[model samples]
Target: MACIQVVIWLFVVQCSAVCFANYVLKEEPEYKHTLLKRILMEENFESLESKINNLTQRVEALEKENALLKHAPVAFLAELTKSVTSQNQIILFDSVKLNLGNAYFNVHGNFIAPVSGLYQFSVTACAATNHYIVLELIVNARVVGKVLTGDTGYNECSSNSFLVQLSTGDDVYVQHKTAGDYLLANPAAGFPTFSGVLLNVI
Candidate 1:
């Protein structure tokens, strides 16, 4: 009888041990899967953060470029009209004063250096008489060089171009020669008589 009892007890203990082991194995598998899911989530968050930083940097760069484009190359235009006694001359368009007889315009303006790169200048003039329109690139009230439009006649146009390295705070203007009765006219609207020059910076 005792032997029988001992065998039954041993069987019961073995079964109990098997049940506990199965439970432990099942629980361990679920914990390992949970840990793997957490690791993947962290990796995904890191990737998203990197993308946001890159996009922010690109956006800042574009904004700066747009600002630069808006502030480059100032332009001005002048028109000529008829007058009663003296033919209207658009003298002194900007920083430059026009002397019709001398055929030169004196230029003066504040020069704010745009960048540390090469710069180009262009000027165009239209008149009603046969004369040469000369363009002088002046730096700080001094003439660096001069370009002549060769031949220009009445109702004709002339232009000149120049390239120079400019630093910040440089001033420039155009001077022209005046002949006959030439007078500076207001560029405002409804003046009847008009004559002037156009200045462009690039």
Candidate 2:
């Protein structure tokens, strides 16, 4: 009887050990599967972050390019071609012989700044009778500068230039401030001209 009890006890111990070993083996693959899935998720998250960073850099570059294009200089040069001395009140240069920078000078003879900037404006007027050639560089209907010819008589030409900071939509043109018909007629010599250029954009 004592021998039989000992054998039964040994058999029970062997069965318990086998069951525990099978459970560990089955659970190991599941644990490994969970760990592998977690690793893949982390890798995907890192890839998404890299893509976002690249896109952010591209956006910044485009913004800088747009800013540079906006601040680019705009300029124009126009000349009065007709030689006949004519009388006028407020003269608008209708014929645009030379125009640059999107041709801001219009048929109304007004230069409208596309962007705010420091502008240099100049005018050359020829006196048919050779006297003080009176012309005003008007900005927004107000006289800011005037041209006065020093030498008076036949075939005399004088020029005056001014520097001004202009905002967008500021109108710039040439007008006669002196009383009576102002002589601006000289077509052959090509002396009468009005011009403006953007020096720096603010």
Candidate 3:
């Protein structure tokens, strides 16, 4: 009877050991699967972060380009072809040497401001022999500067330069201030010329 009891106890112990081993084997794959899922999630998060950083860099580059385009160059130069002698007449400088930004119109002899800014303008008026001329630089019908070539025995020229604040669409031109016999437009004496440039953007 004692020998039978010992055999039964051994069998029970062996069965318990085998059941524990099986449980351990079944849990190992689940643990490995959970670890792999966590690693993949981490990799996806890193990829998303990299894409966000790249998009931010592209946006910054585009903003810098837009700022550069806003501050482009603006300037012009014009000269008269025919003499102007009448008082209060707008001198038609029909010859355009340079019209940067297309702001200067040779047809009506006007430089309309394309953007608001501080500007520098110059006008050179030439008077024929025995004749005098008074020229005015006008901004929107208001005189900002004036030049006078007094009646001298020989042909003479006078010039005036001024700095003025201008708004967008302001009209700028040279006009006859006082009547005279002739304003020298002859190539020999030198033609009347008007020129302007944007100094700084407002």
Q: Tell me, by lDDT, which candidate is best.
A: 3
Candidates' C-alpha lDDT: 0.46, 0.72, 0.83
Q: 1-202, model 3: which lDDT tens digit per residue?
A: 9989999999999999888757765878875677678877878788878998999999887876565468777888887878766676888888888888899998888999998888999999888888888888899999888888856578788888999999999999988855565777865433688999988776
Model 1 agreement with the true structure over 84-195: per-residue lDDT tens digits: 1233222344423332222222332223343433455555544334443444456566666554433333444455666666554455444443333322223343221112
> Which scores better on lDDT, 2 or 3?
3
Backbone atom clashes (below 3 Å) for every candidate: 32, 3, 0
Which residues of candidate 3, in runs, are more than 4 Å off?
A: 1-69, 188-190
| Residue 199 miss distance in model 2 (angstroms) | 0.6
Q: Candidate 2 lDDT, tens digit per residue, 59-139?
A: 988876666467755667667765423444555655566566664555677888777778999988766554445778888
User: Candidate 2 — which residues are off by over 4 angstroms?
Assistant: 1-70, 83-88, 150-152
lDDT of 3: 0.83
Q: Poorest 10 consecutive residues of model 2 by lDDT?
A: 82-91
- Residue 114, candidate 2: how far off, in angstroms? 0.7
